[model samples]
Target: MMHLTSRYLISLASFIVLTSMAVAKTNPACLKHLGGGYGDAECYHGLSADITADNDKLYRNLRATIPLGNAHQKLLNDYMASQNDAIKYCELQRNAGAQWKAEHDGSMFPALYEQCVYNIRKTQSTFLQDLLKMANWK
Candidate 1:
């Protein structure tokens, strides 16, 4: 009886651990955008692609080494300063899309928009952190 109880406890513990990991791994925000069905995957994929392209462009612009006069340099500086905020704005839009999907019973456009927003936030956060570290901003 003692051995059986111990085995049962271990199995229960393992199940709990696995369940927690699955939940943690899932992007609930992304799933929320998925809405009631599975058909929205394509929309999510497209939005993610779009945001990724935007992030790529921003990275290229930031990494450009072209020399500029004070005025142009100031423009670059301003852009760098506001880039994170812009990314956050995109994230908000994405969240709004997710919310719309949830409210509307899983519309594809909203689901895709939410995914785009989440991707933008994730990409922007990572990129901005790297950029700031390289520039010794923080």
Candidate 2:
């Protein structure tokens, strides 16, 4: 019984490692940015799985290739600033949409909120992509 259990445990561990490697290749950035729990496609509310996968690829590439040091720090800071701005902008838009929906007695579309977030992410990704090109990352 002991021998059988040890072999089973080893097989399980190997399977887990291989599965995660495959998943990482498909959505490498999701884990780096969102961490383990929220990294999967199910966490991306509005966008289709395909779109999220593409964004993950872009983010992963940017993260992997970005040069290190002060310039990289500055780039990260700029991204945070943009995120703050996006938050405010999205809040205003959401409020407005809420009021309009209320007036028209329409159902709330949760996807709208997700779409807003996705747009901000896309913009930030594009900026980073440009920066990466300028820095000549291979």
Candidate 3:
């Protein structure tokens, strides 16, 4: 009886570990949507690093590069407002992912959310670059 119980326990433990791994595996579709340039790791991890660096650059550029003037100030204010809206949209996407019911594992939700955020940030970065051009900044 003792030996049988030990074998059962080992099998149960192995099953749990395998199940956890299956659940935790990143969705390949989500990774591809996010550019899939991170090799073995998921795209969210790479995108997280990218978005952080981009946000830092955007912050610094907005703070120091744009000259102080009425036109520039107006542009900056509008950009900031758009940023706030983008943030809200990103949050909505994240919430949707969290509440998604179709996926059994739900591992793709986070990667999808991160992809959405990455796209938003990338768009914002492009807009900022355009603004820089308009301001005649090299």
RMSD of 3: 11.8
Task: Summarize candidate 3's per-residue lDDT along 1-138 as a digit string, tens digits.
Answer: 999999999999999999997656344355545433333235654554565466667756665765666576676777667775775565567567667454445455555656676677667778777766665654
Worst 10 residues of 2 by lDDT: 35-44
Model 2 segments more than 4 A misplaced: 2-76, 100-107
Model 3's TM-score against the true structure? 0.49
Clashes of each: 0, 0, 0
Give me the candidate number with maximum TM-score.
Answer: 3
> Candidate 2: lDDT of 51?
48
Q: TM-score ranking from best to worst?
A: 3, 2, 1
lDDT of 2 at 106: 28
Cα deviation at 94, candidate 1, in Å, is 7.8
lDDT value, residue 66 of candidate 3:
54
Choose 1 or 3, whichever is better by TM-score. 3
lDDT winner, 2 or 3: 3
Best by lDDT: 3
Candidate 1: tens digits of C-alpha lDDT, residues 1-138: 999999999999999999886544333356445553444655455545555555666555655643555465566556655754564454455456666333555445444554555565566747755664665544
lDDT of 1 at 56: 61
TM-score of each: 0.34, 0.46, 0.49
The list of candidate 1 runs beyond 4 A from truth reads 1-4, 11-103, 136-138
**Scored by Cα lDDT, where does model 2 land?**
0.56
